[model samples]
Target: MKALDRAELQRRFPEGVPVQCGKSSSSHLVSPNEIFAVESKMFFLVGPVGVILSFLSGGVFVYSNWSNVLGDDLAFLFLVPIIILIPWLIAYTFIKNERARISLFNRHYI
Candidate 1:
């Protein structure tokens, strides 16, 4: 996205934009509510770590079943993907929000 100039920013958000991370200055003030909101919003920032862990769990599951009778079960094969998919979504949300926050901070707050 194209970045707007200071004048445009001032015109767009006359009250000033609330920054979640970084130091506050005379021009940038942090409000308690804004801070709370930002912190809450930042809760999902696990990124690739979550994804890696999810994959690792899948790997362990596959390895455990490789030499066992469970591997032959059709239900187990179908359920493993579905089971890991729940955690994958959590990981995905975390990664996406983290990237978005980083981009927003770099583009506007720096």
Candidate 2:
């Protein structure tokens, strides 16, 4: 799908939407509840909570599937995609927040 221009978003929602992931229509025009959901997930998936859960889940998974997880010589390669995904998610989150900060509170659409 095509990305919506700044002018079009304003024209579409005069009052405005809560947050937008991007210029893409599917992620934009978001409601406050939707934003809250994402925030909650991030909260649970980050910081101390994330660390604890990671350890617990990692332990369980490793216990149940030790061979599948660590027996293979190439098992460590899984870290590659996870490393790439982390920065990408962070950047995307920042982009969405910047977009909201610049436009959601401004008098004019950005």
Candidate 3:
């Protein structure tokens, strides 16, 4: 879809969002929805990257200590679950919060 023009954007989002055009040192005032959209998009991108990195790091740790890993059955099992879950939980929390924030902003502003 085509991007919204400044006036269209302003009409759609009137609570003053921040927009940074190219080569501009300062951000332009837009609407809350615009800012929230940008922030939510950023969080969406970062969340997956964080999850992938966490899994990779966990894999590396497991591989690096492969010799000792198998011997500690409980530790090994617990490690895998924790490593997988912790990142998932963190990412989930962030996304949830972002959704809630966006929802609230939409309700109040747009």
Candidate 4:
């Protein structure tokens, strides 16, 4: 996308405009939806990477502490399902929020 001047921004997004966007990569934004577009890097970190790490961490925890789990008569074992589902929950939430954010965008990023 091209950089928008104040007049173009006002004409394009007549509802409103944001004064500035991005702390490290500062620029004017035509709309708040731009924030989501600019900050989309978080999706990878909290989505796929986070899900993978959570599964790996959960596996390690279950493996290293298997005996304790059995010793507790499967009480500690209950955590396994929660650990497994947490990634799906996180991913679903991010996807849902992304869909909502996309609906607000004046133009599509991808």
Candidate 5:
């Protein structure tokens, strides 16, 4: 981790070095909720890339299995793309919101 500036240390600590926020001074200052929120946002942003790759690979799989499993029912094939797309859309929305929130928080902090 980078060393803290004097002002940040003062704002967060206000007492002395090794000041506690909750548990340990060094380890427990950041909120887990905020960390989770940021991580969830990152997950959302990256999920679509994985989904796209998976969808393409699944198309190949479906093609390989079509004769034995699906027979001639090509209509069911549409469901695969829809399922991939829906989740990606939801994740994109979540990522957008989270990024906005992070930007706003940074602006306020800085």
Candidate 6:
């Protein structure tokens, strides 16, 4: 996307523009979206990454702690499921919120 001039931004988004920008990276908001569009995009982009990372981290922890786990009772059955579930809850929340945000943004912005 091309950079927008001040005049263009004002013209395009008179109310306000939502921008998502990465920190500590060479990133900039190329354009602004309605709050809803930005939020939906956030869900589409960041939700999966969060889910995958959580699963990977949980797997690594489970693998590294297998010896300790088995030495105990069926603690793993409880612990492992919890570990998997927490991330799912978080991702599900993001997705639901994203959908809501998008819907609300569309209702007002569009």
Q: Model 5 over residues 1-110: C-alpha lDDT tens digits?
A: 22223345346654434424555445434432222213344574578677877688767766776774446677666766675577567777877776776554444422
Poorest 10 consecutive residues by lDDT, candidate 6: 27-36
In candidate 2, what are the lDDT values of residues 1-110, reduced to their tens digit? 11234455555656656453556645445532222211224533454554455556556655666666666746545754464455556656765775665454343335
Best by lDDT: 3
Per-candidate RMSD, Å: 8.5, 11.2, 7.7, 7.8, 9.0, 9.1
Clashes of 5: 0
Least accurate 10 contiguous residues by lDDT in model 1 = 31-40
lDDT of 4 by residue, 4-79 (tens): 2334545666775655545666655355334333335677676777778888988898898888876856766778
Taking all chains together, each candidate's TM-score versus the true structure is 0.42, 0.30, 0.57, 0.50, 0.40, 0.51
Model 2 off-target regions past 4 Å? 1-71, 107-110
User: Whole-model Cα lDDT per candidate?
Assistant: 0.55, 0.49, 0.66, 0.64, 0.55, 0.62
- Best prediction by TM-score: 3
**Distance from true location, Cα of 39 in model 2, Å:** 21
TM-score quality measure for candidate 2: 0.30
- Return the candidate ranking by lDDT, descending: 3, 4, 6, 1, 5, 2
CA lDDT, candidate 2, residue 106 = 41
Tens-digit lDDT track of model 3 for 1-110: 12233344566556665567788677677554444333447777787888898889889878987886868566776777688778789878887876775465555434
Residue 29 Cα positional deviation in candidate 6, in Å, after optimal superposition: 22
lDDT of 2: 0.49
Instruction: Give the CA lDDT, 0 to 100, for residue 9 in model 5.
Output: 39
Off by over 4 Å in 3: 1-39
Runs off by more than 4 Å, candidate 4: 1-41, 69-72, 104-110
Model 6 per-residue lDDT tens digits across residues 9-110: 546766555454667455333433423244436667776787788788789878988887768657766877788778789889867866675565455422
